[model samples]
Target chain A: MNLMLPDSGLLFWMTIIFAVVFFILAKFGFPVITGMVEKRTKRIDDAIGAAREAETRLRSLAQDQERIIAEAQAEHGRILKEAAEEREKMIVAAQEQARAEAGKILEEAREKIQEEKEAALRDIRREVAVLSVAIAEKVVRKELSTAEGQKEMVDRIFDELS
Target chain B: MRKMLVIFIALLTFMAHPVFASGSSEGEVDVAEMIFGHIGDSYGWHITEWNGHHVTIPLPCIVHSSTGWHVFMSSKIEHGHEYEGLFLAEDGRYADKIVEIGPDGSQVRPFDISITKNVASLMFGSALLLIIVLSCARWYRKHDALEKAPGGFAGLMEMMIMMVHDDLIKDSVGPDHRKYAPYLLTAFFFIFLNNLLGIVPFFPGGANLTGNIAVTMVLALFTFFAVNLFANKHYWKEIFWPDGPIFLKCPIPILQVIEILGMFTKPFSLMVRLFANIMAGHAMILGLVSVIFVAARIGPVIGGSMTLITMVFGVFMDCLELLVAFIQAYVFTMLSAVFIGLSRQGGHEEATHDN
Candidate 1:
């Protein structure tokens, strides 16, 4: 009987004790615990979010690197090809100029050789003229020993001259 | 967990058999008095009887009668002695209560607010509960739970509190659980702490706190308010106009009456289940210990053998009561949360959500 029936005095005390426990716990105990847990959860979520953002950024950076490498490769190929073409053009232009210079030098040498031959011929001609004149004078000196012959020769020469 | 308690009891009943034998030299042991006195509340802590003298720690006796307030130590009225016209009632319906010879020549109960055995134990238990929990809470305040996990006693307490709140109370109390969590959590750990303390056979324990109806009643009342007071319209509607056949609701309101009766019955069951479970566990262990004493009347052979057998049974029962302690606490807290959840639902949602 005493076991089942509730006592008013104990009930009163239990109520008071319970109220005290509940009040203290509700005010001091529970909030801080749950708050810490809540704070921990939020912190974890924020970390995950930041990690995901970093991963995306890293991926994009890798992509940018790849793109830049490809562009540089193409630019390098184009510049190398242009240099090859310029080298071919320069070699052709130099060959043509060298051939023109050789032809002009040959023509000047031929003309100078021609001028020296003419000068040599003219000197020979002068020496031949002096020698013929000296031979004619010797023939005349020999004929002059004959005075009478000289007079006849002089009259014929006068007629011929006229 | 109860190793200490069973060992102490073994030392008392087994090693010192003749003490009980000589203690009961007057006659056979009063099994009812022994069992009831162990389970029941008392004005003093009966440690043991040494050299025919009761070694007791007298508690304070505070009583208010029709005369006035009378404050005294329970020691004054020990061993049937009278103090200030008041004494411990030995017989009648008011047995063990502090009563006075009234104007009617019969005994009358005073408005007693004394620090009796159970009350003192409850106080000690609650204070200890605060220390264990508040210390764990101090760890939470000192260190950040967000980055670090709890360890040692703090870790154990955190795990337990989480299990009670998250695994049990959180789901049972539904969406608005946070609003009711404080009271529910408080009730839960209070019962759990006191129930554990009740199993310890020595100081700071050995008193039935949660097993007492008054304590359980107060606990049940906490759930009752958490349910009925904050309940939505659906709760009342379910009680008065539960979804049922036209005949049950319109003609006699039989189903509705049953539904309404269930509201009170639910909390009543919560109260009784906790009280009976713990009370029965204590009774069983005490009964087993008393068995050895009762059978010792036959012979020393029977007594010694029964002592061994009863020790085994007592240890087994104490272990069982230890399990029952946690289970009963969980059951009460879970049920309270469930009742709150049931009441706080929107109207007609039960019809839509079958689960």
Candidate 2:
């Protein structure tokens, strides 16, 4: 078909068509498609965010567990040190009591031995005095029997004694 | 009153200009000279006999009286006579007449009442507009139809629609693409039609619509309207008083003015790029075709070989011109979409980053 070239008349009609078509499309067709696309994008972003948050929470929990284990181990070490100190004190008190009993027994034995020594020394002194007296008596009797002169001297001694 | 003044001045200028006032008769003078200079003594319009490829107009004839001179034309023109006549230049600036003779002894006369350069361009543009809009309407009508439905014109339209959907709207502008697909598709078809028509060999379909600055300016203006109308407050805020450091927020008055100017300049550039490419191609073809004539004036032997070489070369350039037409159309469409996308972008970043 041989078409007529558009003059000012054609241009005016073209502008009308252009405006009407664009206006209709912009109002109806565009919004529906755009809305669907935006919804899909937001869903993806939400899923990604949730995954990241889960990963961070897992990491923090693992760190907390490690710290708790370290604290418990330190408490265990402190209790063991306190028990060892208590045992050492009990052993030192037992050794001191045994040493005091041994010293008292040794003092009693030495006092008994000093008493026996005193008694034995007294008995020896008495025996020596008695033997000296008996010897003096015998010597006087022998001298009287032997001579009349001796009897006269004895009478002089008795007058001196009275 | 002001508009009236302007129109009055333009009218005076048009009347004062000898060309338009002379009517169709005076304009035929150039057509006669162009014909005789090329063809030699074989064909005739009314007069039966030709003396050395020239036909002299009868004295006191409408063609001579009105034109202020008698026209002598030739018959056996080398190119063809089918495309021969006078036309009003697109901007009403210059007048041109050309004739061509095809090899089959046929003459192509370039006379059509309704096919001025601007009118021809407008028609091609409208065809493109019709194709895009009607096809889109058809697609919507058959939206719920089976995937393996019947195919013909609708199928061809589907290919173009998918290309715009995937390549242009989807890739360049991102997912909000659906919102502006119609505009982008319209621009691509409109520009493509005009560009292709501009490169056709003869009338009505031969004016470079996209190459004309006025056509491009109007296209840019459409884009400008779309951007501003659909734009969020964020887009305007960033341009006028952009979020930044306190110093930038203070806003140098001149800087704000220039920022606004940049919006207009961007579309202006789009117009110029398409216009220049099309104009350059046409001028190149005209120059090469002129060469054969220039060569023939020297002598017969050189002229024959030169004509053959220049015509072959000109054909090669015409093929390249076809490719350029599509490229320019795509570039203009892509740029317009990019601008719209830039305008419609969300405000989240501007608020959070102060940028």
Candidate 3:
């Protein structure tokens, strides 16, 4: 066969077929394949977004944990401070209570000592009156018989003393 | 019997003598004889003067005394045209007006063109398209349980589909290609079909459909329209305004104009690259074949060896042409995809007023 260019009939038909085929393929085949690729890409991006969100959540959680820890530390310091203040108050209260009790005891001891002294003085005075009465009775029995003799003796003693 | 034998001897003597040995002859041919031959010349071909141009239109490859070459004009060329041009040279070579040479001398002059044989390429392209499309349609109609992978023809197509899906769309156009996958597949198969048809040895398959500047221009135009129309604000902004210091887009007035021009030229470059590669291959092959004819005429001693060597070289080039056919198709498809990819960037879509 001679090697020559083809006739126009071939070119016309080729163009017709080309246009028709492109139309059909464009409508159907392309969409299916592209859909798959798009799905895969979307899936990947979603995965990345999820991961990013998770990371952010984790960071926030860590921050929250740190905040809680700080609050607990502050609370602990506050409690310790309150406990120290209460201890000082309790010590002061206990000291005041002891002083009041000592003052009451000393007042009672002084009253008891005063009462004992009064009692002893009362006993001594009774003993002294009894000794004076026994001496007078013995002297009366030994000396003067009558009332007159006794009266004269008393007058003589009084005059001698003056 | 004696008369017939003398006539036979005379014929033999005439054949033995080389007519071109000397310009002076018993028959000194005139101007008409040089071009059209004798007025009653059986061959139905002739050259006519058109603005001082010797336009020779051929009617048939096999010219006869009665039926010469036929002429055609641009007005005669149409969408579905069927015509042939033939010219007979004194050297016994039939010159057909096939290639159009451009005014630039360097450029292949653009003119009214037609595919010489449309039926062959059309049939080939249609057959390929029909086979693939119909088979897929049949498979879908049957609604067979979806296989994890493809089988037979479906399997083979599936593999290519997968490659385009994973390698091309997923990689180049990104995952969002689900929306555009159909375009990519159609583009790939369409170009592939034409490429294969082009490489076929004879008939319609070799019209260089994909290589034709007009065809490539159309393809590029589609991409240009598609990309620009669908382009998001980000894609446009990056090209024109850009996302840096205002100075980077410096000499603001000049840069803006340049940026706009770049957008138009990108698609133009795509058109030229594919057309040039395909056309260059044909020119090279033509040059190689010309060598054989030229050498053959210079005496068999040198001619025979040179023709043999050239044919061997020609065969090597033909093999290379096969690789090129696929590469060109791929390049065209890939570039189109890249353009589309650009359009989808940054999520905001812009529509052009043109279809």
Candidate 4:
């Protein structure tokens, strides 16, 4: 029970020892420990921040890639459609030009056939007239001994000329 | 668990051997004296009894008086026999203290600064604290890097220090925790180490430094000063002129008086709480061990059975004491943080209101 009482000697020593420990720990001990802990915490925070930034950047890059791909696909489709339309227009125009050239050649052939027919008719008419004159000369020579037939033939030719 | 078991077996062997060795020559055991002697501070370090011979390490007795400083080995006094005019007081109010024999045959109390058992233990604990903390601090300085993890003793200590900073100081002291963390960390580790060391019951462990009132008083005093000295004007105003009804202040100033008394009681409670808890723990364990000897007064068989049962219970109590040691240290530091935080609250409120 008497041990419960405080002793001056022990108290003095306790105070001295405790004060010395407090000063030493406060100055040399805690700062290093707490500083290190805080530094570790800050490092972790910075790492996390960097990771988050990288994640966002990756997301944006993916989005940009998707956009670019979509635009290229759309441009490819438009170019293909335009080429198909132009090819159809050129095919139609070539068909129309070939038909017009064939019609012009057929018209020129018809004019040449008409001119040759007219010439053939004129030649046939001339031959027929010569044959008729030769027959008439033979009939006159046999009939009246030539004087009366020659006078008739001369009269007919003069009438035709008038 | 295996270590605990070993300690238990060794302790049983030591206790059982002493009884049989002494045998028929044994005298009656003074249970009170035995228990108190185990728990109380002494001038020498008592190890254990062997072959009927008691082993103890005598410490130095240093005293100061009007005459001069008297220094000598405590063995010179021979456990109450006087030597060179100095003696241990055996009776009256100053019992167990070293007193000087005056020329007139009167007992004169000198200013004793002896390195008693408790003081030596305190010094031992201090040395350990210095060695561990300083070495860890040095190691941290050498391998200082923000991203690196701590290992071994430095890692263990860093975890504890971080706990004190984040949980105790930051939770209680708020933004100003940085200013108070160093002191709080020192107090927490110091008390914690001493508490753990006190439970050892052997060379480096038996000294009950934290159980001593003087030591607890000094610890509480540090908290008291830190709280009061750093308090702002608003804190003083709130204490002296609190917001309340006018009638309460006019007649007897009842509220003010209570507030004033509260300031002293807070630290006083801190002192008593730590001292009583530690001392009670040591006493309880000693009392339980003493029970076996008391039972031996009956018969051999019953005494033997009682010894086994008590020994088992003693082991359980020791484990509990280990837990209590940590609890007491934590409670002391947490309370200190709370008191300091409370003192700083007024200033924070005033600052916010002004803004």
Top candidate when judged by TM-score against the true structure: 4
- The order of the candidates by lDDT, greatest first, is 1, 4, 3, 2
TM-score of chain A of each: 0.68, 0.42, 0.68, 0.65
Winner on DockQ between 2 and 4 is 4
Q: Model 2, range A62-90, lDDT digits (tens) per residue? A: 88888888998898888888888877877
**Tens digits of per-residue lDDT for model 2 on B76-186?**
221232212321122221112222233564433232222233543465556565655565555545553332432576556555656665687777765567767767776
- The global C-alpha lDDT for each of the candidates, from Candidate 1 onward, is 0.83, 0.56, 0.57, 0.82
Model 1, C-alpha of A33: deviation from truth (Å): 1.0
TM-score of chain B of 1: 0.91
Query: For residues B308-352, what per-residue lDDT tens digits would candidate 1 score against the true structure?
Result: 998788777877887999999999999898899889867547646
TM-score of structure candidate 2? 0.48
Which regions of candidate 4 deviate over 4 angstroms?
Answer: A101-149, A158-162, B2-26, B80-83, B352-355
TM-score of 3: 0.49
Query: Could you tell which candidate, 3 or 4, scores higher by DockQ?
Result: 4
Instruction: Output the worst ten-in-a-row residue range by lDDT, candidate 1 chain B.
Output: B13-22
Query: What is the number of backbone collisions in each predicted candidate, taken in the order shown?
Result: 0, 19, 36, 0
Deviation of model 3 at B81, angstroms: 14
In candidate 2, position A148 carries an lDDT of: 75
